[model samples]
Target: MKLEFHCWKCAKGTPGRRVTAPFNDSSVYRFECAQGHVYEIVLAQLRFEVLAETGMQALVDGYYRDAVASFAAALERVYQLYCEIVALSRDIDETVFKSTWKLVASQSERQLGMFIGLYMLENGDVPPQLPKKFVEFRNKVIHQGLFPAENDAVDFGQAVVNLVQPLLNSMMPRYTQEIEAFMIRHFENAEGAGRSDRNKHRVFFDFILQFDTEADDWDPAPADLSAELVARRSREIAD
Candidate 1:
């Protein structure tokens, strides 16, 4: 698969070329940009992290609707990721677990909450409630035609980012720590030059890496970005 990387030196997205490397008793793949900055590719959490950052950017750019949608998308990604984690932890078959998720997704009201409850039951981690709130807000905007305010969008986006950051850290410790260190170093350089845009990019780059980790064995359920949710919400609004 073609991967993208942010070159702190180039301050932009660069094409990453993949190469194999030996790790302990086995081999792993790594990516190198043209500038020779090599990084591990953690695809599992990368998708959700990218969605979360896109949502944050939309909020920063004053696109409230898109921000709400993106945050909702991020939250959904989190739910699916947690489900996959749960399944992996239990040694359950992917096909069975995915079929179960599909059935659960067909249900309305607190669907994500149910998955969160299952995860907490198994992992014993009391997840933050912000994701539940964000889901409600997303439903309101998409289904009730409610236009979320700027502050609400910003808060929700930040909350989702805060929640996912730690989860990614725990799931992929060494890789995340390395990425964090790299970003921190670059952040210092950007801060020294007083380039706010570069600093923002650094933050986004960190967010992107937050989702990339080594334990990416399972494929997450596909994200729901369709208009179907909005259409259903519209019908509810009319009634």
Candidate 2:
């Protein structure tokens, strides 16, 4: 997945020099257009959100296998995010937490176990589990090189949405402070890692699954899988 940004100067009704940038963990991105204009952006969405969006896009474009893989990866990333917030609440130093997490980072099953243990410890209940059938479907697509039909991909995507969106909504009230702290640290780390002396402009992006926790009415829109696919297809055609 990649992000596209219009050059700040070129976006003013001029022939826009759209810059395409690689998608990575860093929120801070610096891109130079063909005209030698540079644009730096601060993407506000978390990695999981972007992964979900990438899955949606892949589904829309009929890359069913890729869609399933991305959605599965997004689900694992959600677990990592939950564990990170819990660590913040426990006052675990970021460096120590990261180094410790690295031990299990390469293995998704270990990450899932870590998240389940931590969630049960804090909430006294196990986190929701993905359907066994869906897990098998994902494995078939990801490991067995299966090319699923569009409906199958949509079903997988919706399953992920059903699990992730509500999980995030529930966490907001319970971990508002930790979530905010995570966001602050998220941006700080991104900026710090991409630090440069050159003058740069910063822009925040609104992503497909991003929620505004600061709003009084914090209801998130329902991600109707079929409708979302149709709308995305329409937008692509219109573009």
Candidate 3:
């Protein structure tokens, strides 16, 4: 299916048409803007949003098992997105990032909770307890083959949404500018110097991050700025 994606170059929506190649079983797609910039769609990140939406719908339809599984998949994608942003921001070596991600990705849901706790501490954000609760509920459903209550699925789905919304709002514009600058620098370096294989590579929009003004208010409390509260929140997550 053709999907409408935002072109970072044009800052507008462009259609990404699907292309099927016989040589590869997986489907490929491309988006080209009027400015002659082309992009490849990253399917995995797109799938995360799809699954998240499906989970919410399934919860409403009373498909609790499917809802739990879909939410779990979406949560995993969230971690991947977080890692990618961190790596890019820190300018971590690609090889080292991959090696570290391998170990982090192999962790169980409980371990992910702890990792998130540390992550939030480092970022000076209070870690919400809902993510850990969702992970625990998902683990029960997956490992124990137990069904979650409809309310449990609903709560998990909402929690995941809550966790992702603000993150996307703060990161998307920064990353957009970063990628654009990187591309411009890359092309400038290659100009008149003879084109290399690197010049042929296109920048793809792996994920779409947007903010909703109508979504739940995420106002920070005055106490949130206090060092004592930050310490207390960190300790609360740890315990």
**Alpha carbon lDDT of each predicted model:** 0.54, 0.82, 0.53
Which stretches of model 2 miss by more than 4 angstroms? 8-12, 17-19, 32-37, 199-202, 215-217
Q: Candidate 3 — worst ten consecutive residues by lDDT sum?
A: 18-27
Candidate 2 lDDT by residue in tens digits, 1-239:
67778776665655548778878767778888777887666777788888988898788888888889888998999999999989998899999889989999999899999999998999898788799999999989888988999999999999988888888888888889999889877777666666577544445565556555565655575488899889978987986
lDDT of model number 2 = 0.82
Best by TM-score: 2
Candidate 1 achieves a global lDDT of: 0.54
lDDT of 1 by residue, 1-239 (tens): 12234545455434443233322211112445666874443223234565765665465456788877877776676777666666665667868877888877765345577766876886688765565677688778888988888778766666665665566555554334444443344345434543233313222233322443333632232222233234434664773
Question: Per-prediction TM-score, please?
Answer: 0.53, 0.88, 0.52
Error of 2 at 14 (Å): 2.8
What's the TM for model 3?
0.52
List, residue by residue over 51-108, the lDDT tens digit for candidate 3. 6655654654568888778767766766665555566567777578667777767765
Q: Rank the candidates by lDDT, best first.
A: 2, 1, 3
